[model samples]
Structure formats: C-alpha cells, structure tokens
Target: MRDPDLTQIDPSRHLLIAGPTASGKSALALAVARAQGGLVVNADALQVWSCWRVLTARPTTADEAMAPHALYGHVAPGRSYSVGDWLREVQELTGRRLIVVGGTGLYLTALTRGLARIPPTPPDLRAAADARLRQEGGLEGMVRDLDDATRARIDLQNPARVQRAWEVLQATGRGIADWQAETPPPLMAPDDCQRVLITTDRDWLADRIAMRFRAMLDWGALDEVRAMLPVWDPQAQWAKAIGAPELVEHLQGRLTLPEATERAIISSRQYAKSQRIWFRGRMKDWHLWRAGNAGVHPLPES
Candidate 1:
C-alpha cells in the first residue's frame, strides 16, 4: 500500500505510530514531530519507567532536546503503572500536536478505544489473587473459574493480565468482559488522528532485535540494570522488562554475560513477533509502512 501523505495531515490532530520493537517506529515518529513541530508522547509501557532509559531504548537527550517529549521515564521503578495510569497521564497533556509512539498494544488500544471503568482492585483482593496464582501453578484455572469469556480473550500465558481479571472478579463480582462493556469514550476519536503501523519481515526484525540488545550492552544497559537491582522486586512490573531479568540473573551469578545476552535476544524476538501479530490483527485500517522505507518522511507541499 502507498504511504499516507503525512505532510498533508492537519497539525491539530495527533499521530499514532505503533509497531514491533526495533521496527524504526520511533525514528518515523521523530521525523514526523520535527516536520510538524509536534510533541513526542510515549506510548511504550517500559519507556515510562524512570530507572532504565538506556535499557528501554528511550529517546536520547539530544532527541528530546529537538522536540517536546512527554511521559517518558516519568514513573519511578517498582511502582505499579497500568494502562489506566498511562491513559490518565496522556489525557492530561494539553496543546501542541502529538506523535504518540510505542510497542505497547494495550496503551494504543486504550487511546483509540476507551478504557473500561472497572474499579480499582482492592489491595487485599490483589494479594489474595496473587497468592492463588502462585498456589494454582498458573492463572489459567483462576481465570477459567472466574470468567470463561475473559479466559478466552486474555493471553493465558500472561500472569499479570489473568491475575488482573481475577482481581476484578473478586473485587467487583463482575467479569472483566462485563466491565469492558462500560468503557468510556476514547480520548482521541479515530477520525481525528493519523495512525500508522510499521511492518518488517520477521527475519529482519529478529536481526534488528539481536543487534539492538548487543548495542544496548555497549551503551551501558548492564550498568543501568545494576543500578536498578537495589530496588528490583521480582513481582514488580519493571523487573519483568525484556533485558532486566536476564541481566539480573547475570549479575546474581546465575548466568554468564553471553548466556544473558542470548536469552535476552530470544525473548525480544518472541515479543516482537507477538507485537507484529497484534498490530496486524488490531490495526488493520492503519497505514502500514515497511521498515527502512523513505516514504515515511513528510514532503514539502508544492
């Protein structure tokens, strides 16, 4: 498909750029921001944590200096940062055109389709759900017991999502599917924004992921992980970041540097594959730009 004429887009509307890791989505977003004088807002979940900018591949200081950036590394590590928290933060920003870029599908989904109004899961209930999850070996049984529909919809392998559904059920006595039926209006109407999903061949993406991880190591990602180790909580969301856990294992003397590097690359490749599947399924109507294509740039009007 031909690339959309990004230069012709209204500056008042937001731009959403989503794709797999290392897919050049961030570069495309930055190019658009520079051309349109837009604020680059972060939609990537991991990039929101303040403790590990290098590890997360967050925009460098020079990049942020060129254009306004928001919600990148704003949250302290170990804090529970949810999609709703991200939605709230992004919605609070006013004025300026925005180029929202990230690999987090749920955050993008929340922006395009309104989030559910499910009440916060109580702390006690959350603890109970966690305990049950550990005892049950996995969340499949809990989710199946609580809400069959949610079980079908959720990634069964993701303990966090499954636990969240179980917590919602225990707290509100209503399934997550029911709560989703009460979602609010989207923050940005679909017609008001230009959405693009970067596409790359799987083999190319895998190579990029491997190279990026190695580059990250060269750029002090291991040191970044070491600094975060003092505050690392195995249960915390930040600890589960792609490279953090593997590096933690290395730091703890459980794995060699080469072993950690290999594992991290494999994990990243798997994640990118999942993200590609999600973008293809969820963003069918969004413009698809091939990775490395010059067509992504905004051209001067005649």
Candidate 2:
C-alpha cells in the first residue's frame, strides 16, 4: 500500500502538537493557526487556570490576539477540570481547523479516545479515601482494587487518584476500572484528523529551555507567584504548577534568584523528558517531523 499523503492534512479540521515544557509546541500551533485560519485550543493542564499566566506559561494577550485562541487561562484556580470536559468543548467548537496543543498526555489520550463517564466523587467520599490512602499504602491498594486500564492511566502518586477510585466504587458499586472499561467513541475519527509530534534534538532543546527559564524570571515569574500566594492552596492544581515549588523556595529565602532559575530549568528539562516519552510511546503512530526540518521552524515550548 502507498503511504498516506501528508500534504492532504486539513488545516481546518484537526492537528495536534505536543511535547515538554519549552519545546516550542505552542509556537508551531500558532503558526499553523495563522496560516490556516484555525483556532488554537489549549490542551495543557495548568494553562486552564485563570490565575496562572506567567507561572503556567500561558500565552500573552498579544500572542492570543495574533490568532484565535480558546480554552487557555479560563478556568478558576481552585476548581477541578477534567479531560472529558475539554473533550466536550472541543466537540462543540465551530472552527474549521482545530489545533490542539499541550503537554498533558492524559488530555491528549482522552481527546483521541473518549473518557469514561465516571462522575465526580463527593467531598465525604473523597475524605474517606484520603483516610484510606493515608492508613494503607496508596497505589498498591488502588492497584489491587482497580482494573488494569484505570490503574495505568491514574496518576498513582496523586492522592486525588485514590479518592476518585474509591468514590467511583461507592457511587456506582463498581471498581473504577470497570467503569472505565467501556471504550468511548473517539472525539475525532481517524480519517478526519491529523496528528503531528515536533521532535527536537535533546541538547538544542535543553539550551533553549535554559534560556526560556531566565526569560520567565526576568518577566517577573516570582512576583506573579507572590501575588498568587495570598490565595495559594498548595494542594490546588494551579498551586502545584511546575514553577511553583521553585518560586515558593525563592519566597522563603531558601534559594536565591540564580538558584531558583537553575532549579526551574532542571525541572523543565525533566518535564520535557516525560513529554518526549509520552509522544514516543503513545503517539508513535502519528506523523512526526523535527522542528527546523524542511517545513518546520525551531518551535518554542509553550
């Protein structure tokens, strides 16, 4: 069989650009949107929070004005947002071309394959699960009870995972695994969508990442975090953003500006590694082209 023609990819329909922090995923998405007149919908986890612009690396107002951007920096800080919810919004979007960009692998997975309809667990149920997680080993217990699929996708290290699983069991009288076993229809059919992974050389990416972190600090990332601290809840999703710990350390005088910048750069490098792994393992079948290749630019990480 002949290979599918790459040029036939519809700009107005579907495209995905995903990689680690400072990988230039957003820049490529914006370029495509500008060229094709499509909408740039955020697929990132942290960028959804309204209070986190600089810390979450959300696009600036000027950048957004350059093209139509959606779902970025719109959610309230303390509330929980889910992949399923985003899937719904994406489905309802009227854009001729939809460019999805983000580093959250789970969100991408949920977009490609519809999420399980397990409802939110109540507060009391969550508290109980938290107690159980604290008393017993967390993931080990969840592993024992949950089906393989749920266990695999669930962030085992997160207490939120345990609470959600326990709540599913209570409300639905089924293991969280069982509920998620019902395979959902994909958001976009395979024939209707095109996916792309922007592969970058590791060394080049690392240097770019270091420079971006310095730029972020110069842009007052610490001050942004300080302004948010009056309302900070470390357990909140926004508060747990990648730059949070480093900024908090700076605020506490545990680290100098130079030290915090170094730490943030290191953390971003590791995060990029995780993004690369996800793209390689889960999105391997998708079309891939290295940034700076014939038709590509040295895209900056979002």
Candidate 3:
C-alpha cells in the first residue's frame, strides 16, 4: 500500500517527518536515519535552545546515542536562531541522506521553499524597538502597525516576535514581508525530497499533549526553566518555551506546582492545535499519516 506521494521523493537524499507535538517524530526519524544511514536534523524551534531539554521535549541523551543528530540543543538560550540559519545549516550538511523531524512549520517551510534573507537587525535598532514596544502599549501596537502579510505569519501575541519585526524594519527601512517576497534561496527543492505530515486524531493528540506535559514536569521541567531565569528573559525565545510562562508563574509563587503543571498541559494542547492547523494550511501537499496506523512505513527495517 504505497502512499502516492512516497514515490515522489528522492529516497536517497531526503525525508521529512512532521506531526503535532508528542507524535513520536523523534523516534520515527531516528529509525529512518539508522536504517538508511541518514542524518536526523532538528526542525523544531525549542529543540534548538541549549537549556530547554525537559521543557521542550527534546530527544534524550540516549536518543542521540541511537543515531547521528544535528542542530539539536546547539543554540545558547535567549539567542534567536532564524529559519535562514537553519537553512544554511541544512545546506552545509548537503549530500547526506537527511531526515528532518519537527513540529515547527516555519522551519519546514524554509527547508522546502526557501526563506527570505532578511539580515540581522542592528543592536541599537533592536533596543529602540524594544523601548518603543514598552512605550507604545505593547505587542498589540506592533501588530497593528505591521503590514498585514508580516502580521499574518508572525505570532502576534509573542512580544519578541513583534519587537523583532519592528527592529528589522527600523534597520533595513523595509518591511519584512517585502524582503520575503524577494526570496533568498531554496533550502531544499520540492522535487528533491519527500515531506510527510504525521496527522493524529484531534482528541488523541490532545491526550498525548496533556500526558507529555505532565511527564515533562515530572522530569524536572520547572528546575530547567528556573535555572535559566538568571540569564533568560520571560520574552526571550528560550524563556517563551512551551511550558515556560506557566513555570515562571510557579516560580514566582503565583501558581502552585500542580496548578502550573495543569496550565502547561492546557497550553501544550492549544499549541498542538495550532501546529495541526498550520500544517494543513501550509503543507497541504505533504503525505499524511495517522498516529496509530501501522501500515505507514516504520523505519530501521528489521
């Protein structure tokens, strides 16, 4: 029962395993890499942060030992790593059979169609934007000011996202949307690879999200976030991790550990919904796999 889309991929050079959070992408990708002598690349945003292993559900040390992995937990906390940086890393790893696994649609899109090369915003411009953000109300103001195209793609509720966009505009004297329209270079061509979006039942995924969040907490997600607080701001990319805000509240004595854990679970469920929607709308052409379906190929053939 070959999936119609499976044949379209260059089996030797590319494979993409994507699904909602906690959908076993890491395990599946590891299996594929081990089977085909491929490299498993981290495509998830939070997995790139150095200090968020437990909170972000990053692959464990044992998992890394199972196969070769790249770009996982390599970035310093609080530093922003753009899709462009991801694309460049992928290109540098060229010629290897690669299995990119993650739930971050933006990173996957950058890999497939190429991203706009908006250069880094200067520190002064960023500082000015940060100041303006604090003064002109906040993210709401930035969202209202942003061109519709840019606003549509960015997570408006995230002040960091809003601030970064403003900084780019301040430094380049052009909108981020306009630069994106120019297109940098495709990270990987459509014809060169196969992409799969591993879809799970909504209710099933919701349950998985809840379970995973609780497990992360049990594994000391709070302590990881707490340790990062000295150097990481709540708005910084790492601090804005999936379970971070809720954990921050717990740390501040605002929420009990149980209450914070519950909130984090709820947040993860909501984020999974967002990821599912983003995949449907953005990667419609990708092959689909249900979470529990056994017919879908499992990698690392026995």
Candidate 4:
C-alpha cells in the first residue's frame, strides 16, 4: 500500500521491510516502529559506517528521535564488516520487537535465509584479491576465477561478493555455493515474520533518487567527503557508499560539483536497479506493495 496501515501490523511479530534505495522503505519501517513500538534496526550495509550518513541515506537525527534505531553509522571508516559480523551483532538486538529495514538485499536475505558459515579468507588471499581489484580496476580476475557454481550463484557485479566467493573457493577448496548448500537454520525464518517488499515504477524511483542525492548535497554530503579526503581509500569498504567516490573526485578537483552530482545520481539509480532485481529474485514470497490503490499482498497479521 502507498501508506501502509500500521495499525494492522501485529505487535508480536517482527517486520522485515525490503526494497530499493529511496523507495520509501525506511518511512514505512518508521511508521511500523512508531505504531507497534518496535526498534528500527538497520540492515543496509552502507549505513553502518560512521564515515557516511548523508551520502548513504542513513536515518536523520529527527528520524531516530521518532523511534529507536540501532546499527546505523556504528562502524569505523576502514573496518571490514560482513554479513556474518552483522548477524552476530543482530543477536544482541532480538530481545525486543524489531522493525529491521534496509535496501541491502544480501543482509535482509541472510536474516531470513541462513547464511553460509564460510571460513574467513586468509589475510594474504584477501590482500591479493584487493590488490588485483586495484590493479585491474574491476572484478574481472576474481569473477573469472570463481568456480562455475559460485559464478552462477553470487552477484557478478558486486566486487565484494565476487571477491568473497573467489576467496572461499581458493582458501577452502570449495565453492561458496557448496558451502551455502550446507547452511544451518536461519536466525529469523520468513514464516516467523511479517515481510514486506516495496515496489515503485522505475521512472518514479529514478526521479526520487536524483532529487534525494541533490538533497543529500544540500545536507552537507560534500562536507562529509571533505572530512575524509585526508585518509580516503577508494578500496575501503566504507568508501563504497554510492556517492562517496564521485564526491571524492569532486574534492580532488577531478570533477566539478555538477559532474560529481550527476555521476552520483547515475550510480544510485544503477544500484537501485540492482536492488530491485535482487528482491524480486530472492524475496519472491514477501508481500509486494506497489503503492496506490494496488495495495499489498496480505499476510498473516500475527
């Protein structure tokens, strides 16, 4: 539904809100948290780093003032946070009602669908992968080296996913897909929660993304980038925030502000497109809400 009936949400069940960036998912989650007295936990990977708030579309202070929020901007600038790490942290938050929300499909998926307990990649292997990424400026080598099954299963366009698969295959002599095939039960099974997937028309979402990025610029995103210029590392996990690279280029005088804004908007739109695809493929059973009078696919209230 365009405006979900938060009153209809069952207080006993957790809410899982998933959608592309700028698709009003956070707004819906906030409404649920307020109406149902649930904690709003972030599932978005990018919003975890302290280095980016405005650029990553993190909840504003006013938003947090409205409801309790956890896991937003809690990570240091150069840390390597993973879905496994996020899952560990999420365990501490489960004593209360929760409205876990974000556009990061991987995190949301792992929350409901068990994540593979793949071993950590050796530091040398990870370093080698990172080095190759910098030298090649793309995931070509890592993707090519992935086992056929992993190559089929992981997101090819996601550098982190590709590198992780490559590392798992190299370090363990088994494909990630093989490891995933042995995953244990999920921490939060889909049947135990109220799952909602927000969908919008493509052009409408693109317009929202562009306007949102421009608004982010107004909200001191450039200044945020300026703060990081002294220690900016393009390969850093936190540096992968969609607009961070473009803004970095802007600060370096490699691009004008307008050019950087355009690039950031383009990147956001592309990322949103990928997110939509991910949810469609992975969250097929989630109640799909197309807004307007189309409404939502009803699920169990409790």
Best by lDDT: 4
* Predicted candidate 2 versus true structure: per-residue lDDT over 23-92, tens digit per residue: 6677777767766778888999888888778776787777799999999987887677777778888888
Candidate 4: the clashing residue pairs are: none
Per-residue lDDT of model 1, residues 149-208, tens digit only: 777777777788888888888888888988898898998878878887888888967877
Q: List the residue pairs that clash in candidate 1.
A: none
- TM-score per prediction, in order, is 0.92, 0.86, 0.87, 0.91
Error of 1 at 250 (Å): 0.7
Local distance difference test scores for all models: 0.80, 0.75, 0.76, 0.83
Ranked by TM-score from best down, the candidates are: 1, 4, 3, 2
- Weakest 10 consecutive residues of candidate 4 by summed lDDT: 293-302
On the 0 to 100 scale, the lDDT of residue 114 in model 4 is 84
TM value for model 1: 0.92
RMSD of 4: 4.5
- Candidate 3, residue 65: Cα displacement in angstroms equals 1.2
Q: Model 3, which residues run further than 4 Å from truth?
A: 1-10, 147-161, 294-302
In candidate 4, what are the lDDT values of residues 1-302, reduced to their tens digit?
A: 35566655668898888888887777777777776798999999999999888888888788889999999999998678899999988878889888988888889889998888989888898888888877755588788888899898777987877888888989999999999999989889876788888788999778778888888888898999999999998888888899999999988989999999999999999998889788878899998776432233221000
Model 3 worst lDDT window (10 residues): 293-302
Candidate 2: residue 248 Cα off by (Å): 1.0
